[model samples]
Target: MTVFLRLSAAAVTAVASCQAVGALAQEVEPSDRATTDRLEEIVVTAARRPTTFQDADVSVTVLSRIQLEQARIRDIRQLDGVVPNVQFNESGQLGSTFISIRGIESNPFIVNRAAVYIDGIPFRELSNAVLNQVESIEVLRGPQATLYGANSESGLIVINTRAPTDHAVYEGRFTTTGFQGGTSAMIDGFAAGPLSETVSGSLAFKASTSDSFLRNIQPGRPAGEIRENFLQGRLRWKPSDALTINATAYVLDTNAPGVFDQEYLPLDVDLYNRTYAETYNGGRTIGQFTYVNDAPKKTEELETVAGLSATYQLAYGTLDAAVSYRKLSTDARGLDVELTALPTSAGQDYKVKTFWNGELRFASPADRPFNYIVGVSHYRQDDRRFLATFVGPGELDDFVPAPVQLAEARDWGAFFSANWTPTALPALTISGGLRYDRAHRSADQTAGSLDLGPAGIFVYRDASLSGDFDAVLPRASALYRVSSQFSLYANAAKGYVPGGFNLTAAQADLADQVLRYDSETLWSREAGFKWRSSNGRFRLAGAAFYIRADHWQEIQVATDEEGRLISSDYIGTDASIDSKGFEIEATAEPIDRLTLTANLGYTDARYRNLQLDADTNVSGERVKLVPEYDGYLAARYQASNGLYVRAEAALTGEESLESRGEAIQPATQTIGLQLGYEGPRWSARLFVDNLTNVRRSSGLAFRNFAFGNDGNWYAPIARSRQVGFELGVRL
Candidate 1:
């Protein structure tokens, strides 16, 4: 309740401020109006078709190239506050990134509830959604199953990279950043030009190196350090006026050394202070960015993606076809169960060797009174993983390997959607879509054993499992044009995630119960309005939504009948959730060359029917990782002499870190400032992030009591204050 009140007050204050600015602008001379600029019209392709922002009957947020540059948003985590009701949980690892949208949460063990698309390739894993040389980003909220199929229950994010240009262009940038404990440097370059009369090509690359902000307190131990490189290339061919083809490829490599991505700390503040003072920091309590570990740690990852797409103009409609391939491999070694300087370590090696997908679609002319689209898609993936644990002085060199797990999946879907604008009711438009999806998954495990001194030997059971799941999703929407500058829309949709087998469950007797989990489904309903002034100097959009989820999948501990710990974890489907939320976004140009933007979101999400175990029933507890409220407010002023200043604030409400609400994260507010100069041939900027030096955990996990819990929790601390300068040149 308090969070909601604070959000309401902030909203009111922002509105009043904007109104005062508008009133002040009204007193300007009539001749000064010529200097004012109208808001630019934005066109989006989130619905598998092109539509203006006001004409689309869905809740969405669009960021253009200029906005991305001004905000200095280079990655996905930076979008948390800019987009309403969205949060990114960073674990410090390159491959693990969990996302929460509108109270629907995703973790490292399960598939993402929200889907992400870069270029024409899809990503369903919990991986970093990096942005590079991107032209625009579109965030569409609600269930998008009718068009995107499964794994889009919460929402969808679409990223379109800058395409090859017909004329020659070149750009380069260099950056240096200083933080609490270290400094980093980065370089980026892009080049594009015409190769021939019918072909054009482009290349973009970035490289960076940074020292870890977190210091190691242990003697002779080093802090975590990182090095990264990225490259992308594109080719476009226009053989004829009616046909076009595009091919793109990208690669990312990351390496980290010294410390693991996470650390353990006592949950109680007093205990934390005492423990750090006595054990790690030599009687000092200032150890939030310091840790002690004896075992060697390192992580290496490589990912590659390639795609091809073609479009042809036809007599009946436009035809489009696309295909993509992706591969990700990683090897990491770090501490196992103990957070202190104990001789315990763990290792993980995984490879996604084969991931391929393809799609074909056709759409009718948009000018027609009645238009439609039809499409079909297929996806396949094969993965293999290996894990090991080590104890004693040997650490990671001498270890016990777990079962070798191999998994494969295949999916197929067909969908259709249409819009109707009857002549009798020209002011209203109705649209509907439906899709049928089928998925098959299988897994295999090789037997293995682990030997722990004095604790007895543990055996992993050999298993083979398979499952088939199917779903029919549907969606509908209606939009009413109240006036040329105002509209109202309502939408209802169903989304789902396909079922799969759990290859890691090791208990023989509980195989049937733990080996397979059912698919998860959600139904969402939303209503929203969009409005703009006559001169387009002001724009406002708002939406209210409700969602119900069934068969929600979760990663749970595997235990025997007597409640004894088992060898592995399993996926379970024994919970449901109810979520309701509302979001508001406004953009105003109160005066010439000055822009103001504000967005606020509130969500009330709770478990409906959930059983963590035989002894616990959490029916009304708040959902984990979902904040009660979040918002962003920013102001930017650009002078005619090429100088600009921007100031922004981000607000996040409290959140529960555990299912039973044992761990809570308090609300926080952060501020940022930027000063820059833009010229025809050169640009420069100086910026400060997290100006208040706020220290907090971005994510948290509980340790099992049997595996050295020590009444503490594990988490990754958020970044500290950072100041940076960037210089760029265009040729």
Candidate 2:
């Protein structure tokens, strides 16, 4: 029995477009607030170990390192909502980092509902690193699959960088940033000390040059620029003290300008903040190349992570182990855009990628109440796709073409989790875990190829698909320490994602055939509560959830039985689905000199009978940005001499841009401002971002034309709304 239907009633309104830090802990965190202790400070890998934060029961959000040096955040999408429902999308790469937590997001070849870790490892691609050595950022909303497995089923972002610190001392800091019109320069610095009497390590570097904000009217030309660079180094060797070793190396060179996301406006014309110069002068009238990518797509990435963890000393406690390695590469230039869909020629497309990963883990030791963790993971990927279309003038055509997709993938997994607190029931704590995932993929399609001259006949075909997949993910949680500040929790979970193969060449491949998409699952349930107030400051938290998916995937609109109109691939899978949410985060200092932070979220996405095969219609569409009122609030003030001030406000309300079909973004609000001065080593500042240029829209790309009448002259829209200025220094 299959079902899925709903496309009437004015089509459910449209609009598409869609951090952690810790320390100085004492103890007495019912999750946060005027609690007494001084540094019990807390954390729980979102239900993995070293618990705190009201003993945790899911529903999480944290950011420290002085709140990322007071919001001067650089990557990690500005830590988005400070938490709550987590929302972030950056089709622009490097700046936004494509992520939508709480609301779960897949796409980028789907397969991650929310899972990204660093420190405890497991970072296959949450948009690949780049946060300049962060020290904290945790957001474990719901469905963390017992402990962040099974793609997390839509909740998890554990990033904890910045290690080797306890003294033997010397530190460093430096920063420079500016932006307007297109975008401009940026620099970063870092340093650490001590190599004797045990060991030490640290070093960082960042570089950027921006200038691309779409405004190419196709003429003599001017406007379009991009540049980026990064370098990193780290080493920690303990020789003894049980066992410890860490080595890290990083290098990223993305020449930027893959067209900076957009600048070639031809979709009729809307001149939005106009300005383009991403370079691509090959003269002559051309209609479109699938939105245009006239070459200029560059990428370079290098990563090496080495680890050796140990804590031995088990008289019944203390034991840990870890191992890791990863490598990746990307070379892009997609514009093979259907010869501008006959705009008379000109629309480019390209693809190239290489990936690798490995992991290992073990754990046990939490002062005993029974604790455990185990793991094994592996992944490999390779891709090469290219097709250029343009048929006219000075006559030169890849003579006509068809897709030439290629792929190589290998995945493996074995995970475990356990936690049981007994000893007179310290308030009840029982957690569980399970993971056994296996995936193997393959593909080959050289369907067509040619290099014809004198512009004429063209033909190519061979779309391929080779596959294999297996899955099993399960998790559980429970907590009821209803005192010492309050607590109550419950959880259950299951998740899966594994499907591959799709590489095509077009000449209408005989009407159409070349679309692959399958692999999706979800099952979740949750509950939560927490409060704090002992003397540390003030804190509060909340959570609630209910989700189910017996197969849920997207990327729709497939056709071709002579009816033509076949290009966008990836089909749908259905069955009643659900998503409920609630979050009310808080932090306060009231007087000591003013300091406060706030976050709020209310999410709900639906479509309970969109099954397939057995037509079961159910309308009431609303699930995409999963917005039912999101939130953020901040205020900082420190006084003991030098003056300082800070204020922030954020609100994201309005959502419903589902895919597998259609929907785009509309509805927004954003604001920020900062002023500061502090002296100890050195400090100075001034900042203003967005401020008002709130111009927002993000259905995150999904519009193409050329079928029934030139599809609006080829549509493309993705980035706009940026204001920047920053200065920082500390030593």
Candidate 3:
């Protein structure tokens, strides 16, 4: 309640201030609706067909190129507080990002509830969601299984890159950010033009490096640093008036620091690090046996993606076909502080993932009273992982060589959807879709470990497991056009995450007990409305949604008879969860030169019935990482002389970190400010993010020990306040 009050007050103050400033401004010509109407103008392809935002019955959020710049959203992590009912726990590890939508949450290290698509290519992992050379991002907030299939239980995010054009254009941008701990710089640019009468091409590049944000307490060891390079190219060919082809390729390389913060540092030493030194929840202090160890360690990553797409304009319909291939390799080394206060030694993990996918789709003409689309997609992914651990204090003595863990998966699906409008009442439209998915997965694992109780006991194990599953999902929606400017929509959808074999079962004594986990399923019902003014000066969108999920897959940690701790990454089934939320987004132009936008979201997510073990039944606990209330408010003003300024603020409500309600995270608030000037060919902007430097933990976990002076709480610190300037030029 208090968090809501604070947010209300902040929003009221901002609105009042903007109104006061607008009352004294001189009258000017009405501004271009193009800039502010970007949301209504956006056309999305989530349904395998091009549909205007207003016509799409699903709940979605669209961010255009102009909006991305105004918000300074560079990566997925920065998307926090910018959207409604959307949150993330970014562990900064390769392929480890937990995303939640309306309380549907998944483990970061195990699987994701939502799927991500780049230019119509599905990515099994979140490592490729990086923001660069992009055009637009569309986030569907409800079940989309009819078209997307698995991993769409929560929803899906579709990112479309800019296509090559016949017109010649070149654009470049440079930015540098400075803070108390470190500084970073980046250069991004792109060039697009026609190579021949029937051919066009575009190229984009980005390079950046940053000093370590952590101060190494260990002598002679370097601080954590980051370096990255990204490059992509696209070529398009128009063979005839009926056919078009495009090919794209990209390469990404990044090196970053591994495992962070052994223990919280003192306030004087690190302003960002917080501690529970004198708390009563756990008996812990900063001056324990464990100390900071910011050594010169890093995780190297490389990713390459290539794709080809062709569209043929048939006499009766349009045919689209695409194929893509992606490869990812990562090598990491870090200290293992999970078990003991003293360093157990260094640990390393090397992994490689390869993915191949193809899609074919045909859509009827949109101008007809009845429209339909039919599509089929096939994808296969293979992974190989190798791990190593070196143990010792001063010198490396004991060495554990882990066997390779391998997994191969293949999925194929076919979907058909149609839209019908009655001739008598053209304002009423009915839509429905159905999809059938079949998946085959297999795992090969060989695990090796070193025991360290009384006498050193080494163990080696091997296991193989395979599984096959099939699902049929459906979707239905209705839209009523009340008027030219207002529309009401209601939809019901179902989605699921496919089942797979557990590779970790090889390490334990009982392999069959944990060989595989079943798929989780979700059903959602939502109602929403869209409204806009004739002049595009005002826009409002809101939605109310309810979701029921079954067979939630969860990891459980328990102890064996010998007091040996064991963790099963994917074990749970038959548990249930329920979530309901409401979101409202509105934008108004109080004056011709000023635009004010505000969004409010409320979510109540809780587990229905869950059995942690034979003796414990935890029901009605809040879902992990889903906040009750989240919202943002912003104001932007532009002058006829090409001058502009903007300010925005976001508020996040309190949330529980664990399913058992053992840990909780407090509410957080952040603000941003920007000032800029634009000319014909040049533009410059100065921006400040996290203006108040709020320190809040995005996630929480348990330490290795039961209880001790060292706090048993594991929380990753987020970035602090940053101020920077960006310059851009176009030719």
Candidate 4:
């Protein structure tokens, strides 16, 4: 609460200061004005319809192409500081990214709380390479289930790739980066042209390889390394002025050697040294970004996506239809549970063989007093997985692997949204939406066992589970246009995540109690204002939101009566969480040839009526992995000679790593600088990131007293300082 108040006060002061400066600028002569006088108007499709940013009632942030380039945001993980009230937890893997929005968290083992859409294809688990060649990125904060359906209890992210050009165009970019521990190079190319009188096509590709910054300190062990390749093609056909069709296909492949996605460390350095340093690490202290593991490490992944869409102009409205298919396969090994050279490891193989979705929608003309949109969507997926755990010796070859797990899921939804303006109140607009969604899930697990020479034989039981879940989501909002330069809005919405069965449970008796978990629901209320100067030199937007969630789902590591580890699965608890936050964003051209931008966010999220287990009650505890406050500031200057310089800083507040607040990550601040020159057909840039060499962990996992360790805390540390040069050419 204190943080929120402080942020609110600061935002108000900043807005007032900017307004005063704008007024003063008007007193100057016309010739002394900035080169770019007015801010560009941005249109977004977050509500399933095109609407101006100032007119839309939702709280959204849009990153334009220029902004993306200035911020050097090439991957999703790089957006952590630039986007307000959002964080990307990097697990140091190719496709394992966890996102947190407004204090709602997602992990690798569970479905995402927020949903992401890339070129009309839904992604529950996002990949870093998907951000390449994007036209714009839109982030909508709050419950978006009314239009996006399930798994959007937190928010939504929409990414639109650049479309095919009507005229021939070619572009290429090359970059080389040098960091503390390694060097890497990447090349990106794009080509587009007209395929025929009514058709155009575009293709883009990216290839990169690098040595991991995290080193392996053990003897004769190889250091981590990564190689990635991506390719995408897009086709657009305009049969007539009233009809259009589009198709897209993409593939991504990655290979990582000697890299364990997640690495465990000791909470107490002294205890760790006394326990295993002499025997495992040659009597050396375990430090950050260094580990000792003798197991063979490798991870391979392949992903493919294809999508098609069509739009037709109707007499009174427009109709749109889209279908998409996606598949992902992963094979991984070399996960050392003990963080030692003791030969205890794990491996997994999983394939999402069939995943597809389709949607149809109609939108009425937006130039009328009353407009509406109606849509229906269907989604389905099937997957198979195999897991192995090796305890004492030789890896997968000598161990008995776990059973093959098969799962299937299906979902369907229908939604309607409308906006109305009363004749008596022309300045006030009211909007409302409703959606009905249903989901079905089924899973089957085959029995298996593990044999430990002197220990014992562990046996697994076969199980089959099926279930159905449903929800009715609704939203309402009102916007009042005070004038052409200012507006105020308020909205409320509901969001939910469907229930699912836990097939990992081993014991039949435990299955009855932990076989299924209930759905989680959230209600959010938000109010905000947007303002722009009459001269259009400054813009500011601020919002305050409150959210309440019920039936929080958490992963529980089950243990036997004697404190022996049994299994882990998702479980619903009699707990809830309340989050309150505020965000402020502003942009201004205070003087000629210069631009300034700043944003700040604060979230006060805490648990209520919470119980982790029979013996632990964590009421009033702050949510894990949620920062209390985050902020960004940047300034850029452009000279008449086409040379530009930009400086930026990002700040992140302290956060707890676990629900019990046993481990806390301190606050961190980083600085970045860029100098570039742009010409008619060429560009070059020199950039430096993390100028102060700040070292911290991007994410943390708490695992205590497991795998015969006193305290095991796993983390993925942030990269050190980096210097890079980039060159680009267009023809």
What TM-score against the true fold does each predicted structure earn? 0.91, 0.33, 0.88, 0.91
Model 2 lowest lDDT segment of ten: 10-19
lDDT of residue 499 for candidate 3: 77
Q: Rank the candidates by lDDT, best first.
A: 1, 4, 3, 2
140-204 in candidate 3: lDDT tens per residue?
A: 88888777767787888888777787776566777777866667777777768788999999888
In Å, residue 304's CA in model 4 sits off its true spot by 0.1
lDDT of every model, 2 decimals: 0.77, 0.56, 0.71, 0.77
Per-residue alpha-carbon lDDT of candidate 1 for residues 1-731, written as tens digits (9 for 90 to 100)? 23433443443344334432222211222123225445668788988888988888988999987788888998878888699999887665454777788999886667789988889788887455357788899999998887887878899989888889877666667777888877777767667878999999999887777777765555556677777789999999999989999999999888877756444444454565565456644564536566666556777788899999999999878999999999988766664344555444444444545689999999998888899999999999999887666656554456556777899999999999999999899889999999999999999987786543222244666878888999999999999999989999999999998989886533344646677899999999999999989888999999999999999887677544433445455778888999999999999888888889899999999999888877888899988888999999999888777788999999999988767777787899999999998765557899999999876667645543234334555566677888999877565
> In angstroms, how far off is 435's CA in candidate 1?
0.5
Q: Which stretches in model 4 have alpha-carbon errors above 4 Å?
A: 1-37, 265-275, 393-400, 450-459, 505-511, 559-565, 704-709
Task: Give Cα distance to truth, residue 306, candidate 4, Å.
Answer: 0.1
Give the Cα error of residue 199 in candidate 4, in Å: 0.6
lDDT of 4 by residue, 1-731 (tens): 23433443443344334433222211222222235445667788888888888888988888876678778788878877788899887665454787888888776667789889998889888754536787788999988887887877899999888789877666667777877777767767666778899999999887777777777766666777877889999999999999999999999998888776555555455666777788766776665556677666777788899999999999999999999999988777666655676665444434445689999999999888899999999999898877665666554354346777788889999999999988899899999999999999888887786432222334556879998999999999999999988999999999988878777643324646567788888899999998888877799999999999898876565555543345544556467899999999999887777889899989998888677668988889888889899999999887767788999999999987767777777889999999998655557899999998886666655553245324545566777788999876555
* Candidate that beats the other on TM-score, 1 or 2, i.e. the better one: 1
lDDT of 4 at 155: 94
Model 4 lDDT at residue 163: 80
